[model samples]
Target: MTDWIASPLEWLQNYQLNLLFSAVVVVVYFIIRRIVLPKLEAYVERDNLNQQTFRSALFTFSLLSAVVALGILLLIWGINIRELLAVSTGIMALTGVALFATWSILSNVTAFFILLSHQSYRRGNYIRVIDVDNYIEGYISEINMFNTILITEDRETVVYPNNLLTARATIINPRDRKRPIGKIEDFRKTETSVDGGLNDKD
Candidate 1:
């Protein structure tokens, strides 16, 4: 009976630190989601942005956080960092040469998260992007994981890169399509202009 009781106590003493750390990681994850998610929603809602996109962002963030937490737990239970890096590298190597050419695609994916947080653009919102080469005036039709689909005033469809859209100065028609010409607000700067650039009427 003493041996049985001592065995369990010894096991607990050995694993108690791991148990405490694991609990901490779980609690922190919950705290972050609880505090951060609502703030994200509030920011998106304040701008009248898409809740769907914000949810997508939240899902992505949550998934990454979960992965990190899992890694921490594994480490607490004794997984080597070098071993983890080797596994990660092996997985990357399996992707082969095509991975080398995915810089633009990866950048756009990263930019999508950044763009979704902006106040100036939304799905179905009429706006004009003042790109480096020229300007695109259109109604935002679809925003995907890679690109933003724009339907121009001339009935043309434009597949604009999320990276460029975030980088450039965009004009949003605040009154929406009904008043598509007056009071253009810049994407980078929140200032509104009435008597100036891009005379978009259609």
Candidate 2:
């Protein structure tokens, strides 16, 4: 029993550098989580990102950090970094192919970055998507990584793919208008004025 315990301890002592590297990785991870993450969160908050968008961005950042940390740990364990990178590249290539096979998934991810960079729309802002006889008008409730949630006038929630929004023309109304332009009453009034002017011309 003592030999079993001592054997593990000896192995650990033999790889003291690896042990120290592991400790350093742990410390760095904690620093990122505790300090870096909070700063990023604050920045997102300051920029007025919604809760869902902030959480998605944070999660993506954490995942990337974990992947980098794993690569460092592997390097410290005497693995050839070149070989590891080659393997990672192969895996990424395969993943890229898979994502390409599902075009919407890839497009949405691309559109997400585009949306992040452009502040044309935000939560609570009304937007009208111009489509062929399918004009969608709603207030943005949430903007997630893959989709933008819209709350319609009738209180119905609609999920629109990010890519679709990015690909199309969207009219954003920063302030909720008391009478939306699409209202029947407004259209009738315009039509009546046109008719009255036409009769006067006669």
Candidate 3:
């Protein structure tokens, strides 16, 4: 045991190269997180998505990034990649069989990520989800990890799955756009059309 304590400098000298490479890996991971996460958070805010879902997403992505960093470290330390793949394969086989029935849940979670990146879509947007058979129109209330909460014009609530929403063609800004009018035109326009069109009143 005395020899172990006596060779601290020798041990560091032997592994200094690996340690330096590991430090580089760690710094790169942190740099990626610092640059990417804030932009994601900004998109979340701009889209008015659920903050709770954002926190969940952050945790999930961080876990993924940690796993990737660990894999790189294992490679740098001369660990056999095959063993890592074997263990990963075994885990996947178990989870895949167990989760076969609930695979849609995974799809919904992934679709939430896709939906989260769309900066133009917002919680307050009046959107129409159109499919071959029919369509549903509503204002987006909240976008959670699994489903989107929509409030219809009739005040009825629709809980739509994220995957389905991503599959469908969504019409945003379906409402009419109006041109800005000056004071003179504003005074000239005494009434609006009952149909919500900008027609002059007789």
Task: Kindly indicate the candidate among 2 and 3 with the higher TM-score.
Answer: 3
Candidate number achieving the greatest TM-score relative to the actual structure = 3
Task: Supply the TM-score for candidate 3.
Answer: 0.71
Clashes per model (N, Cα, C within 3 A): 0, 0, 0
Worst 10 contiguous positions by lDDT, candidate 1: 176-185
C-alpha lDDT of candidate 3 relative to the true structure: 0.76
- Model 1 score (lDDT): 0.70
Per-residue lDDT, model 1, residue 197, is 39
| Candidate 2 lDDT tens digits, 1-30 | 999999999999999999899899979997
- In candidate 1, what are the lDDT values of residues 1-202, reduced to their tens digit? 9999999899999999989999999999999989988877775666555667677768777886798788778878888879988886785564343222344565676677666666666667787776463566788876655688888766778888887777778768735442222333354343233333334431
Query: Would you give me the overall lDDT of model 2?
Result: 0.74
In order of appearance, the predictions have TM-scores of 0.65, 0.55, 0.71
Of models 1 and 3, which has the larger TM-score?
3
Pairs of residues clashing in candidate 1: none
Output the better candidate (1/3) by lDDT: 3
Cα displacement (angstroms), candidate 2, residue 197, comes to 21
